[model samples]
Target chain A: MCFYIVINDILKGLKNQEHKYIAQAISIVENNSSLNKNLLLNLKTSSMESIKIGITGPPGAGKSSITNQLIKKYRFEDKSVCALLVDPSSPFTKGAVLGDRIRMRDFYNDSKVFIRSIASRGSKGGLAENIDYISDIVEFSGFDVIIYETVGVGQVELDVVDSVDTTIVVLVPESGDDIQVMKAGLIEIADIYVINKYDRKDSDKLFLTLTNMLQLADKDKWIPKIVKTVAINDIGIDSLKDELAIHRKHLIKSNKGLDKYNDRFIKKIKHRLISDFENSFWNKKRYEFLNSEIEKDINDRLDIDSIINKIKSI
Target chain B: MCFYIVINDILKGLKNQEHKYIAQAISIVENNSSLNKNLLLNLKTSSMESIKIGITGPPGAGKSSITNQLIKKYRFEDKSVCALLVDPSSPFTKGAVLGDRIRMRDFYNDSKVFIRSIASRGSKGGLAENIDYISDIVEFSGFDVIIYETVGVGQVELDVVDSVDTTIVVLVPESGDDIQVMKAGLIEIADIYVINKYDRKDSDKLFLTLTNMLQLADKDKWIPKIVKTVAINDIGIDSLKDELAIHRKHLIKSNKGLDKYNDRFIKKIKHRLISDFENSFWNKKRYEFLNSEIEKDINDRLDIDSIINKIKSI
Candidate 1:
């Protein structure tokens, strides 16, 4: 398939909830490590405009409000901005007051602002395998900035944020406590921390605590600025932008962002290959066989080692 | 360099906190989807008596204490059981309390009880590569049952335990209340449920809850027996043994264990081969050239696609 058309199919597949095709596309994005003859040519020919900004935070830290604000700001800059919010599909039925797009509906009607909601669809990472690929497609669709809005704070979210140039961590006044709860994962990953709901009375106390914590905890000298933003009123959005600029400056000056991007590129390649290797080895047929094997051994009573030797002999 | 010698070095290295070998062993385990001929032969030749079992539960559910009870049970069993408690490894500090062994030190004179506490050295999965290799070594040393213990639960742990003939899940009185938390990971994985600390006031309440909850869930049709064990007094040890025998009888009679064993065997072989293929690719002088290309591009802030192309060319 032509690269553009292939990306379109992926988008259509995601939109239609075609799980298998979505999985396949994600595999491709992850394995973009391979320098296929066709892919390289596409890269050269494709005028895919992309601004991939990754956002993540622990639950109840107001990441959505920050995303809503960021998209609005980018819309002010230009009309073409696509925001893709990846939601946790597993926990879907539990409760959701505002699904991604609905939560940020103010700019939804503005043709300049394109918003899409994606269910996580089994990938532990907030954004799945082909998300970056999808982001590229939207960017090429003429969006100025491709904003990746991830739902929760976990290893996978941290990983995605690190892969991008701009990694914004959303926090709240009470997030200081969560920061302590989640320091090991968060402290190392964030390029900037936005204290959402900054109008809260304890916001100042939270800011000082964050700074002190950063100083004591970090040795590589990554003290991400704690930007305060009352996202509901959009009070600190401009300052957040300034902090982003400053952070982006430090990233370029230190060449740190470039280093991380390279690392991610390498990782993306390896990860895709590894997962594919697993998928092929344990595809439907293998899964069926495994299920039967499980039935005979643990459930139905079979000799475990002998059954294994049977497969190995095959 | 030999398999037997390498296994010895691994244990000794871990004992002394010299972990280069562990990292290498981990690299092998991490590649679960593939394995090659030479590596298999090496592991096979160096094989030791490792009794593998599945230990699973919900988060913060006292798996560590249950693990201690299991080891303590093994010491009572024959004094020839080497207990390996895997996972629930916190990286912050090298925790000194080998919690499982501390509860089971009755074998001071019995040199046969070799206990080692293992953590997920890198990823979330407790045992993947090294544990298998470590099991091989311990088996060669002739421990009767190489009791493989896992704390807390997940898919990977379930997969590892599925490789064994018997699986045990240790739970407390509160397990009934939190059964929902474990249904996905441990619900179907365990062959037996050891409800430790039956002396606790609410043990009956917990037991009733477990029965009611188990009835509510579809357990892939296996009604795994819930055996109550007051481990502090070594209660129900005989019944646990009798139940194991009964399960083993069914296993030998049904050929079910053999089939599941076959599934695991096929997987392990694939894991070995995949690792070999990638290692050979990256270990060559070619990898350095690829690194150089990536370094130049990243450092010079060139495009990612270009560096990928350079690496492919090398």
Candidate 2:
């Protein structure tokens, strides 16, 4: 089949919520380093009211368990769910380390629920960009909710803010001190804070501290909701779902979703432009010039400004 | 003073090994997101034989203590040393947690040893690129040795491989399982592996395991050197320094240094090109276009391919 026919069938399958086409579409995006603009345009025109949620936390904070519980709550309401486990580890390693697979095993055979793991593959920014695109692909396939579960306490956590309508930062009683929390910049990114393993020692103290911290910040905007849970026991799962619903409602009422969509578009456009430049600009002659320039004695090497200007003229 | 005269003075001060000029030059690079080609060009003509060594590992690996000991050894020999503590954490946080400052207090009054800490500031690739430029400034300032101390076990560690001639991966007895060592891709990046806290349980075991793992890999290249040290007692530091000198000689004999230099040049050029593109391409008009495109109804939005093409045409 020709490329156009394949893409058309995929689009039709997406509208019908076919499993094969959804997987195929995700594969196309995952395999290509550059954004698949053709497929993206086709997917953009078919919209769904899918809610994108991001759940991120440091390792061993029980993010996967919380995600599994959330999935159960959504499925019970007859809502289709898609979970993207964004693994920031080396791409060569398997995703089993996160325990996301075992916690999410119940939905393995469910046609309405899909779970996929994504690796960074040495591209830090590209991973988040791909997540933005893949979320759309999943939403186009008729899923009602998309959850991005990323493990870590770094830039990856912050990047999720750009793509998702609601961001939930999971923490444990043992997460760290107030300084570490503030240093991670988690306060700014979280729409909801889940203090998982809430029955553990100092859980209440952490909850109160976070509450006070949030109160001290700008109160005009949406103050983040704090929910406590022992995710393994499925405790507070319903309340978590209720908070998500309320947050989704607030997003619509405040029109905050439009701002998020705008940010994603700007970032995607910039990423595309850079990718295109990298793809098109380098040639054999330019490389040879760089090599010879470096080969010059340290005292004789040309200025970088002159070299950059020359390359532009070339 | 005008820009040219001030820069010329700074260059002269750097040649005289003045600390003020070194600090000012680093600030210039850190404060500017783009490469300052003029300053870099001025730096190119000056030459000094400085050895750059990178020390990286996971947190709590006693890296700072080890670094302190190395500084002591270099100072004992009357060699001027510059240490760049590349903190991968949030820029808002101080670098006190790393303990590099506490351990190196002995050298704070010693003009022969210069220490500085760098933060990521939300730019992942840009941090490594700046490190490359900073190393040159430090080298051009008559420092005999430049050591890059980064705390992490991820992309930052790998990126250091491009800028430095030697890389030392530090590990504690309780670092993790064999799987984690492989998963972190540590086996591939280590030119030297230091099993610190050697008195702890399983230090010998980790040493043997790492040695066997290295043996199974490609033997045509220089086999990674492994060492054990009780950094607190200053045990085995001389041996570590010996290993560094041997590696330096091997790099010279094997011409591996040239390959590293070549890789650095390519990456710097690419980073420069992307930085230029981002600075040049974005404007009020392009941002307005992006805003309008995203503001459209989901089903009526312009295709990303067409939008990118349109922006390019404009």
Candidate 3:
């Protein structure tokens, strides 16, 4: 009874758009606390829809700067925004996290903008799995827009694409040769391509290369648009914004928007069911059984059959 | 009875070190065929232990060239080598696969050398899961050494490290600055650091950076060694090989070698069990139930508890 009462207060606070409650709700989800399921399930369904935007690119592609600019643009239109920046625990990429946080500090005092940095160290599913739940929390908080920013490493990009309606693939003049871009599968995933750091040398050359490549892409779907921007100087941001608007329109017209939402919905339910099943199935006795069997002799494959039999019996 | 006979023949051929049977056996595991388990379990344990070496680095770091050169050196000593090159399906990096294959064409005709490129496109566990099983197959075939070469993408490097006895992190002078290297978590994982393309200007700068970083690392553990090489010219590979030998000695003396093998053993058991459980638990009915529930209303969290209850009922 007491636990339910506490949850009710948190839900009440969330309904009031209190940042404190929002942060607390997100923390509960991040930690996977015992109360998380109750809190998540009891929260009121969002009547106000929120747009999810994903910003992804290779390291050093100015993704952070562009995200900052986008936040400002959205805020100017009086829309509240929540940004989730995924920081990989890798030491090589850790420095960039600090750099990104520093660049986006302008919104620190803005009550309407919420910024959170998620550590991708412990999560085996590469942070994307949790992003879905986190996005739900923020969306229910009445934020008009939610942005997911991640560095392109491993399966992170593909995972991000699966969860977001709009994906912006940020690149720079020196990102790579034309062939590298095509090979990265960046061309297919991007709803909009932002060639950031347009002030840099050879920016036009890359712009033209991307234009030519995109021309060969499938005409049946919404063709991705390329925009050049000097993120630091804030040039060409309006054009990028315009492209996003146009892409959003395409998403609705083509019913790809509904499709993406449906995909995410199905994926979430599947993941949740699997997780629930895993928890129930892998009991302490089973784990001990597994460990003892492995301790006997790792190289011996004789026990594998017995193990499979046990699994089958379930 | 016929399947048993076929398995017996393959096992006998494997004992004779026939490449055809080895290829067939590997294909069975790769495809996850039903006969894979029976064949894998029946194969004789390795009497001739094989050394496993992992060569990894940034995409343009001459990893393939170094792998090719290492193969040549091992072949000259009359030791058989099996190299598993993991080719990421990302288009940006796909071109390099062709380039690497062309560079390594010398070993195609060598009877003692077996080179197989594993496509990482479909594997959800990022190829590392299968690498363990495949390595066992090759080791059972009496190979002298097994080399795992992967580009540093996603968690592939970390996964490769988990499976290999020796890890060599290859980096070119142009890879990144010291901070970037540190952030990538490369400094901690490398048993040996190779500054490939050392003939390039500023190669010495990277070498010095790596040395300073190593000095700052834990003194109790084996301090990582840095080697400079112009892989294209086949310079400094002997030195790299010598470092590998020294590292192998360290691995054994420190008992870390046994620890790595044990860790792999435990992980293989765990992964296999989980996968088996997943297969049994996610039956057609459960999947159909999940899909139907999701299609009704994605936003409603009301059905989540019912789903959890169903999962728990198992």
lDDT of each: 0.55, 0.73, 0.72
Ranking by lDDT: 2, 3, 1
Which candidate order results from sorting by TM-score in descending order?
3, 2, 1
- How many angstroms is the interface RMSD of candidate 1? 8.4
DockQ for all models, in order?
0.07, 0.27, 0.32
Scored by Cα lDDT, where does model 1 land? 0.55
Writing each residue's lDDT as its tens digit, candidate 2 over B13-34 gives 8888888888888887777734
TM-score of 2: 0.82
**Under CAPRI classification, how is model 1 graded?**
incorrect
Stretches > 4 Å off in candidate 1: A1-218, A223-254, A271-314, B1-51, B87-93, B96-110, B119-127, B147-159, B166-221, B224-250, B283-285, B292-313
Candidate 2's DockQ is 0.27
TM-score of each: 0.56, 0.82, 0.86
lDDT for residue B190 in candidate 2, whole number 0-100: 81
Local lDDT at A189 for model 3: 75
- TM-score of model number 1: 0.56
Report the TM-score for the A-chain of model 3: 0.91
- Better candidate number, 2 or 3, judged by TM-score: 3
Report the C-alpha lDDT of model 3 over A3-110, residue by residue, as the tens digit: 778777777777677888878877776676745644584344432267778898765677778889999999999999888887656544455567666777898789
